[model samples]
Target: MNNKPVGRAPNFTNACIVMFGVNITWVLVVIWSLWGLLAAVFLGLGVNHLIERGRVWAAARQAASIRRGKRF
Candidate 1:
C-alpha cells in the first residue's frame, strides 16, 4: 500500500465542474417547478421598487434642474 497521490486515475477539476453544473441545473429546475409563483411575486415587487425609485430619482433631478435654472 502506497500513500503517494496518483497522477491520473481521478480528474478532480472535471468532476468538480460537472457536479457544479448538475447541481445548478437541479436547483434551477426545482425553483422553476416548485417556487415559480413565489418567484414571480418577488420579481414583481423588485420591478415595482425599481420603477418607483427611478421615478423618484427623475423627479428629484427635475427639481434640481429647475432650481439651477438649467440642466446641471
Candidate 2:
C-alpha cells in the first residue's frame, strides 16, 4: 500500500496551490472575464487576504495538534 500525498487538493480557493501536477484554477481570470478589471482587482485582493488568513489558521491548528502529540 503506497500512501503519499502528491500535492495540495483542488478547491475553489486559489490557483496558488499546486494540485496533482498543476495549478488547478485561475479564479481572477474567470472573474475578469465575467465582470471587469475593477471587479477582478478588488475581489482578487480579498482572495489574497483569505489565503493569508487560511495559512495562519492552518499553522495554529498544526501547532496545537503537535502540542497534544497528535499526527495525521
Candidate 3:
C-alpha cells in the first residue's frame, strides 16, 4: 500500500456541490472550502520539504532503527 498523503482537495469539491444544492448550507460550505485551501497549502509545503530531504531523512531514520534493533 502507498502511504503518501492525498491531502484536503476534496472539501472544495464538496463545497461546490453544497453551494449549488442547498442555499442554507452555503456558510458551512464556504468554511469547508477555505479549510481545504489552507490544508492544501500546508500539505504542499510539507511535501516539498519532504521531497527535498526525504531520502536523507529516511536513510538516517532507518539506520537509527536498525541500530536500536526495532522491528515493524
What's the count of clashing pairs in each model shown?
0, 0, 0
| C-alpha lDDT values of all predictions | 0.78, 0.74, 0.69
- TM-score of each predicted structure versus truth: 0.49, 0.52, 0.29
Q: What is the per-residue lDDT of model 2 for residues 14-37, given as tens digits with 9 covering 90 to 100? A: 544445225224666777789988
Candidate 1: what lDDT?
0.78
Cα-based RMSD of candidate 3: 14.7
Off by over 4 Å in 2: 1-27
Q: List the candidate 1 regions with Cα displacement exceeding 4 Å.
A: 1-34
**TM-score result, candidate 3:** 0.29
Model 3 segments more than 4 A misplaced = 1-50
Candidate 2's displacement at residue 39, Å, is 0.8
Candidate 1 residue lDDT tens string, 1-72: 899887866659988979977975676667667878577566556766998999999999999998999974
TM-score of 2: 0.52
